[model samples]
Target: MAKHYIDTQSLGRGPQRLAGQARVADLSRLVSDLPAQGDLVVDWSVAGRADSAGRNFVLVQAQGSVVLQCQRCMKPFEWPLDISNEVEVVATEAELELDDDDVEGPDRIFCEGRLDALGLVEDELILSVPYVPRHEVCPGNQPDAAPEDEPPAKRESPFAVLGSLKKP
Candidate 1:
């Protein structure tokens, strides 16, 4: 079982509360290939909870600061991430129905084996990131005209965004 696994025994005893700190550089999957891992850190908490209907669930909350390359400026900018989600627990993977056209219920996760904590938080962090990260306004981009002495900087093609997807 994973070291951070949340087993049924813990849930049976009562609600389980967990919290920790993880450096952004340590979570390879969370910030893959982003420059300047630096001292960025994420504070995360996971709690076993039950809804009003008594259905078992896990409430995952995470707060972190990340650096993302601006799609417009191609420069790095800080983005704050505060994610909280309640995922319903199911007995088996078969209960997860993605094709249901009816009113969708809360997110569902299987309760078999081990429910990895760090992995779950990382997943939520990834989803919290903007599809296309950009700064409100690029640095030095003002209403005033550019100085003539400084040569025009080369601009990256729009496809530059796809560079992150290429195999290293």
Candidate 2:
């Protein structure tokens, strides 16, 4: 369905890997988090493999940075992106439903023929975004001035002691 779609069955039979880098703007949902395009770039990959138990899984990974306005200070800050997820692939909806209750197990998805490669990557990226965008510490934390009632803390110059010693 997508340009990057791949068949899960093929992936399970033989290990296959796909990777690429794309501008943040290319991700429809995640791009909305950016204040500006800036240098935001996403590197992503999808790989398929089978465990010793013969269970088929798709591994997805993506990393990037997004520029966002701080909910606290209203200043733009960079949010680092790191996403890594693995999901089991099932051929039928019944299998997906049966696997759904196993919360501890890897997520499961159904595949008729192929999986949407780009769509999967985009979903993972979107989940990485914070519900409320904010910086750990706002970059614009510097206050403009001292409060009206308080005087600025006076600083004693390091040379003051030397100057006193030099007094004749």
Candidate 3:
């Protein structure tokens, strides 16, 4: 499918809304971080409006699910994605910098007329992913756990071996 691009300037002139679905496979950057197997679904929407202060802002909402490797079990698990963000559109870098100190304000983005909607969705989705993903309770036995029947192998300490080799 052909990609869509938005004119930030036009969005600023009036309120606008957009919604779409993007296959996880199509988002290369986001897909790279996910596991090879399983299907991923991404649904997203955006609403643009001019605030009372005359600042242009876009409200982004996205939901999806992808198979991610569990850090604890070293197995694949389905991870759900849900994200919502309000981004202020700024005309220049200076404007973005000025808003940096406003800790409570919405996030800012610089636009040069056009913006890629798919890229925005992908970025937000990536940010929503957890730093370390794992199931609440592992699905099966822990990988490092020793089997119930056999005793763990015993090995002498390297230091003890070295001491024995040294002259008395």
Per-residue lDDT over 1-168 for candidate 1, one digit per residue giving the tens place of the 0 to 100 score: 124756633465578777898888787886886767789999998888655655678888999899889889799988998999988777667777754564556788777645778888888898888989988878977567779998888999999989999998
Q: Candidate 2 clashing pairs?
A: none
Model 1 scores a TM of 0.75
Model 2 poorest ten-residue lDDT run: 1-10
> Global lDDT of each model?
0.79, 0.80, 0.81
- In terms of lDDT, the poorest run of 10 residues in model 1 is 1-10
lDDT of 3 at 57: 84
Please state the error at residue 90 of candidate 2 in Å. 1.8
Q: For model 3, which pairs clash?
A: none
Ranking of predictions according to TM-score: 3, 1, 2
TM-scores for all predictions: 0.75, 0.75, 0.79
TM-score of 2: 0.75
Error of 1 at 128 (Å): 0.3
Using lDDT, rank the candidates from best to worst: 3, 2, 1
